[model samples]
Target: MSGEPLPPVKRVVIVGGGTAGWMTAAALSRLTDAGVAVTLIESEEIGTVGVGEATIPSLLDFNRYLGIDEDAFMAATGATFKLGIEFVDWADRGDRYLHPFGIHGRDVHGVKFHQIWLRQSRLAGRMGQVGNVSDYCLANQAAASGRFTRPVPDPAAVLSSFSYAFHFDASLYARFLRGLAEEAGVQRIEGKIVHVDIASDDGCIRAVELADGRRAEGELFIDCSGFRSLLLGDALGVPFTSWQHWLPCDRAVAVPSASTSAPLPYTRATADSAGWRWRIPLQHRVGNGHVYASAFIDDDEATAKILDNLDAPPLDAPRPLRFTAGVRERLWERNCIAIGLAGGFLEPLESTSIHLIQSGITRLMSLFPDTGPAIAERKEYNRLLRQEYEQVRDFVILHYHRTNRTDSDFWNYCRTMAIPTTLEDKIALWRAKGRIIRDQGGLFSDDSWIAVLMGQGLIPQSHDPLADALPIEEAGRFLDHLRDVIARTAAAMPRHIDFIASHCRSDLAA
Candidate 1:
């Protein structure tokens, strides 16, 4: 970029159509100008592993950027509000905790609420019963009590900033985004990528030959072809860096079930002998899945576990999905970029699949590739995507490694396995002083680390000293106030289901 003109890679072809494909389409349509051409080629024949229905709060930004109507999106996607994720038995049998969206209570006396809570626990000399920090967190309290609302917190207060995400049918979301992107000038082609035409000397893909024998050429290519990675890996030969050793869960069996009970405001992930089960409450139905280590469990056993653990009667046959845990060595190389499952797969242990896809799209926009770069830009882009993936990977691994469970071989293995050095350092720092070190490019925030670390029983050796600055009686009053305020605010919100009924409900929701 040092005086060199941005190389023109005007025509772009995206090769797939699920959440990733349409998400890419929606973003590109917004960025590309009138003359620039964007074509997306996806066949209806190939099935999508459309179980990526849960998301993080950050998705609000994506929707806001696209100016997508919230009610319309909800109606089209059969969406339910997601306040957070509930981890059941991750630390030990029968234990449950939530990793809520948004921040916890307001920092008091320039100290985090959790730190103050830690000090209060020490003052009370309560041993086994750790302070329930979430008791004061707005989103957590609201989720616990089945409440939902658009936040209108006072500028000086903490609860005002509570955030939320959504649980929607993935296929419907893709369709919804497809409409947005197409209406914004993105051309959609229905076909399979039979072969990738590449420039022989540079090895950069030039076009994709559709099964219909029509040639769709582009100066740049986006590979959203899911696991096959048609353009990036399959055609271009980009290497994949596997992380199967650290994240042992390689397969999942997904099934939708009829609504059996009132939908929970959060996703529920329950631990088991071989792996874990996810219950995502969509407005109309529940998306259930069992993700397990294929090495330790068979398809039948895995599917059985999923069916046995379902909260409602099965609505459809279970669908199996398989993948290794890792990312493409280079998400972008030459003129091609890989997004979504083509880029990597970290178990949705934290509902990060959509988040990571968003990350890739955002990063691609920032370091948007051209026919030529300064060489440094490519290096920087690769470094950033690599770091993003590693940071997210480690965060997911922390849940498995920081736990106290040992009831099964899966649990025993996870409990003792060595983790990434980066995660180990973070854990060590938190234990030493209850301090969290944030990676500038990392997606997870300090509060996020605290929530998971404390939820999984990683008690810090010492509390934040700032907490000691306040007198014990004063701290008690503040903590009580925080708890009471959260209770009242959450109580004032509409019931979770009622919120949808009154504000966002539609034919899909029913």
Candidate 2:
């Protein structure tokens, strides 16, 4: 080893200022020592694509690590608790199922809970007493009843099996984080980036020239420039790999509408002819959007579909967004790291957009190069990020590929399209035996995979052989007891709106 100590990274510069940019700034500001200086530059002229965002349960960890109070954060963002996502009409015109946030029934005698349920369900089907899979899930049951409660820390508790996330106004969330980041010493600059200067000798970013004739220099750069990908794509020339062939909804029309009723503790994604529509409830309004392929439907028609399907009258004109489903060939290149929409985009099908940003932040922090960017660090970061993206891509593809909906050309194409070999193997494994291959560092758990697979109507012919080892009478009793426990626990929870009103109600003026 060299006698001289490695130099520390002194200055870090971030581009853009939406949820991604602010999230990066807030995290680094709170985590990094005073030796590092964090600065973010953004322009008021650029409008943010701030649709209502639905997140997964992992967001709780992100906030907790940053020491943010959950109730305070929710109030600032006009947020609502989310138990799970209810997918409607994906399998067939009238079919519905929930992809919940947490586990289902408790495991029995070393066999997975789902396996036991599968066996009992099969037997029940024969006896004409089959039950809806939702009854076995605490989150799904709570969601159905419009209830919400935080999970107890005790693993043995029935309520502890469930987890929760949030539905919040993205713009408000950005503003909320901006306040925190600024308080933690993140300097915010207001200007459009006119140019990105690269070091002639190393080809790394040296400084960004603002439109106001000023330049901001830094040793490291974080690109949160949304889909434009200013630093990574336009400057570094990183190539994008499009997954449109496998996942093809490329356009979305978003609008907010009046809330017609008490907000449910879940997001609703309903399938349409060309694509699907999303309904995310917030304290003040309902966020509605239709994600569809432009080839099959026009922008005007897509907007009309969204407006027509909204639960209430529009609050404003619909906004349109266009994006391709894919990520850059490498997320980290040289001294610059790309996060959020700039790194890539997978449609909010499973509401993974913000979670991807959170993951990127966490990974960057874990492999943080205090001595400046190293090739090895960049390689490992890119490798891990690629795995994360691919894992989510495969899960999203499962929803489309396994669907029985043959109602439209869109559905037909999705059902028949060739998929990644990774996804193909997963489907094959599940079909052969009810086994879900879990990704070690993946965002979605085995329960998530099981929910989507079974919710979409794919049933394995056989479960784990160990599940059958139990006597039928015993297994049936275990199943009955589990269902009863979950249902009763869910019934005792307060209504979602009541929980929010009492614990985290927004103080924002109408």
Candidate 3:
């Protein structure tokens, strides 16, 4: 059975007005051209958790789909380019690695690049020559040297090998997108939702009531209410599934600090005692936050740890955020769909906060329903989003679970704790054959898994046998040539700060 179908979605109401709401509004505003109305409700009194300062390359596609100008968006949001995340002390104290945004090296005869590098490095007398896997990646090289450039479309060019994202002010990004969405005929209502009205016959959300005695009705409802889940959870009675046992860091203290140096073109996730701290470099300030497990450390201690670790003076007192690492059991329940924090939060370990929101919006667009009671659509969306969330969850858990740090109870528990069976299987496969088996349609690429697994010191038991097709001497020469070309190409690129200065400098800090 194809399930029931009702009237087409005419008016779409989005609850909340942070990055999620505006991003949803902006994306759905395109529907207005097809005679669909989009309305967004937000309260000025309730501030947003605006600390999703780092993003992945997928955001570039989201912005492009919305027809946003790259330089203008960057300038408005005080954004700097992001090659990838630099993980510090994840595997153990004093360890560092880059989970870069592009491929490692050119695969020879359909064999994966890492397998070749793995085979060559494991051979006697070639360990020093091959160096770390990071050496073969262009993104890693550029990030290490503070270089930034837009990738070329030419497959032959070394510059085409890597991609980039952004480090921007989340609040400003919301505001920037708000202007676009509003300009595209999206209506905005300023008010707090005091009640959600559910229909009797069907469990679909009928409308949302504001505290100021206003009612906004719509055929379709999107919950971007950030942790509140006003429509989906509160009214529709959808339940949340907690992943805390696997991902235990439940609290975060975030603060903005003055930029001490030129902004680096990447985000930094440094391991802390109770959890981990993030360092995101924007043009104006550095976004710093300590995400720690409250069970092992108090709020005061977490705040102090972040303050003490700052490279520059604080711009504001630390702000605290509380959340469970989980998602709603069903992302789309009935006619009400949840996006962003309202749907779930997997932490910002991989800088996936915004990406998840974008993913939801994209999936919705693809499975966009013209009628009410979109049963098949909802089922597919829930399945896709659930898979995406689990994929990201496993990747995040890998950082915490694969660590060698035993200095604190937090690390000890994380290191010794049992992980999900899915993650276990992935790790086991990697251990067996240096092969990264990524789920189909997963957010992260095989290169991403390779980076984190190898960075955290999880080497495979053996290389792919296909890597042995090429002679050892030939493979060594190929690695040397690739490394030299990447180094020279990276050196030739403009500095990250320089690229921003010439293209998209906000000048807000100055």
Per-model TM-score on C-alpha atoms: 0.96, 0.97, 0.98
For residues 1-510, what per-residue lDDT tens digits would candidate 1 score against the true structure?
134344587788888998999999999996567467888988889967778999998899999988989988987888999988999999888889898886777787688777877887766454434348778778888999999987765867655657889999999999999999999899999877787887766666767897889999887788888998887788878898999889999999999998877789999998877889999998889999999999888999889888988777899999999999999898888778789998888989899989888988887777775563326667887789899889999999988888888778888888899888998999998998798879987888877887799889888988978888888877787777877887898898889998988878869655
Measured by lDDT, the strongest candidate is: 3
TM-score for candidate 3, please give it.
0.98
Ranking by lDDT: 3, 2, 1
How big is the positional error of residue 40 in model 3, measured in Å on the Cα after superposition? 0.4
Cα shift from native, residue 117, model 3 (Å): 0.7
Number of clashes recorded per candidate:
1, 0, 0
Error of 2 at 107 (Å): 1.1
Instruction: Write candidate 2's Cα lDDT for 1-510 as tens digits.
Output: 234443467889999998899999999996446678999998889867676489998899889987899999999988999999999999888999999988878787788888887777777543444376667899999999999989999988887988899999999999988998999999999999989998776677889999888999887899999999999999999999999998899999999999889999999999999989999999988889999998788898898899888887899989889999999999998789999999999999899989999999998998988655577888889999999999999999988888998888999999999999998998889887789878788788988988899888988998888888889888777777888988899999999999999999997525
lDDT of each: 0.85, 0.89, 0.92
- Give each prediction's root-mean-square deviation over alpha carbons: 2.4, 2.1, 1.7
Residues forming the 10-long window of minimal summed lDDT in candidate 2: 124-133
Query: lDDT by residue for model 3 over 1-510, one digit each (tens)?
Result: 234556579999999999999999999999999999999999999978778999999998999998899999999999999999999998999999999998898989999999999999999988888988898899999999999999999998888999999999999999999999999999999998999888776777778999989999998999999988888888888889999999999999999999999999899999988999999999999999999999999999899999999999999989999999999999888788899999999989999989999999999999998865688998999999999999999999999999889899998899999999999999999999988877988988999999999999999989999999999999999999999999999999999999999999896857
lDDT of 3 at 98: 96
Q: After superposition, how far is residue 359 of candidate 2 from its true place, in Å?
A: 0.6
